[model samples]
Target: MNPEKLAKLQSQVRTGGKGTPRRKVKKSVKPVVKEDPKIASTLKQLNVQPIPDVEAINMFKEDGKVIGFTAPRLSANIHANTFVVAGKAEEKSPEQALSDMLSRMGGGSLGPDSLSQLAKLTEGLQAGASGAGDVDDDIPDLVASEDVADSKTDLNAAD
Candidate 1:
């Protein structure tokens, strides 16, 4: 080959090592979602009243676990018999829960009426918990052979 042509071909091969460098792909922009104005207006039309002066909401589970919501936003609609409680719920330890209840009671004294109500609640809860495990006479314990055969026949007929 001629020296000039060889030099020109070598230079072209070196320059065209990889055909093209890839461009960095841009991240897609997320579209902002706005609430529908019509729905907003409809919600506004509902005569939902705000309930004030509620500091905390506590839910006591059957297993002694308590879900406490401090600084709750409480609201109610009397006509609809609906209540809305919005808050950041936090599970507290048993000690914390006891103290919270004590604090709510100011004097740490439950009156006779309150005590009776508490006793009733406990009794009811205990009864309900025990009742769940008991076998009732109404529910059959064993499946009859004839009933099983009948169900199998029905299934075979469908096929």
Candidate 2:
């Protein structure tokens, strides 16, 4: 090879002129504020002591009972405000909004016991409306053995 060509090739390799671009150096960012001593002190005061691995704290419980401390604090004021706002937004009463929310939460319009009571009340209302001996003898027993067998057959066929 020519000495001049060899020298040119060596220079190119040494300088990385024909290779990948050099990465840019990043500027260091300074924090906006100094750490507050009061905040630091508060954090130190609130810091729970580390329990030994062998004697791990039961976060879900204390003593033999479920820990009440684990429950999130109920903010009645916030709840009331949210309820009011939601009611106004939907043109509904707060009570209506609360009922709707309960229903959406899989609680239905009434609680399980409340529903059972309501059902009994409705039955009593119907019986009272029809007077004494209002129980219709024509209504067939829904859970008879033949009905059960038919239902079982239907369910099995569906599967």
Candidate 3:
């Protein structure tokens, strides 16, 4: 072998064919679900009955927010007063919610007294919204006014 050819061959490093062979891992097709037997057993033993014929359910939250559920599945355990409502929760404004509640109550018939009370309530709400004036405009000027306080006190007076 020629000296030049031998040096060239020695400088090159040997490697496995292509690269290291990778193992084909089998992935699970179904997800693994974990359940608690304690809660499940007691819930199954309860005599919870379904509340049928309910059109929808509305829940009122703070800040005049309303949560509504349409065509919900309502179940109640009358013995324990435990109720379960399952459905898709939605958002509705206070006006829409009030209208819906009225419509549900006896086909939306309002007497004279009910109309007057509603009108009064709406007027009260509107009066509070009477545009934004200057923040300190309504506050009276606070000055420490004590004109009649006795200023002369004897330091060495004996009782």
RMSD of each: 18.4, 27.3, 17.7
Q: On residues 57-115, what C-alpha lDDT tens digit does candidate 2 reach at each position?
A: 11211111222211222222332342101111123332333334445555465777765
Q: How many steric overlaps are in each model, in order? A: 0, 0, 0
Candidate 3, 57-82: lDDT as tens digits: 99866445579988998878988888
Poorly placed runs, candidate 2 (over 4 Å): 1-109, 132-159
1 against 3, candidate with superior lDDT: 1
Superior candidate under lDDT, 2 versus 3: 3
Assess candidate 2 and give its TM-score to the true structure: 0.16
How does each model score on lDDT? 0.69, 0.44, 0.66
- Candidate 1 deviant stretches above 4 angstroms: 1-46, 93-95, 107-159
Clashing pairs in 1: none
What's the TM-score of each model vs. the native?
Answer: 0.40, 0.16, 0.42
State the weakest 10-residue window (summed lDDT) of model 3. 150-159
Candidate 3 backbone collisions, by pair: none
- Give candidate 3's root-mean-square deviation (CA, Å): 17.7
In terms of lDDT, model 3 sits at 0.66
lDDT of 2: 0.44
Model 1 residue 67 lDDT score: 88
List runs of model 3 lying over 4 Å from the truth: 1-43, 106-159
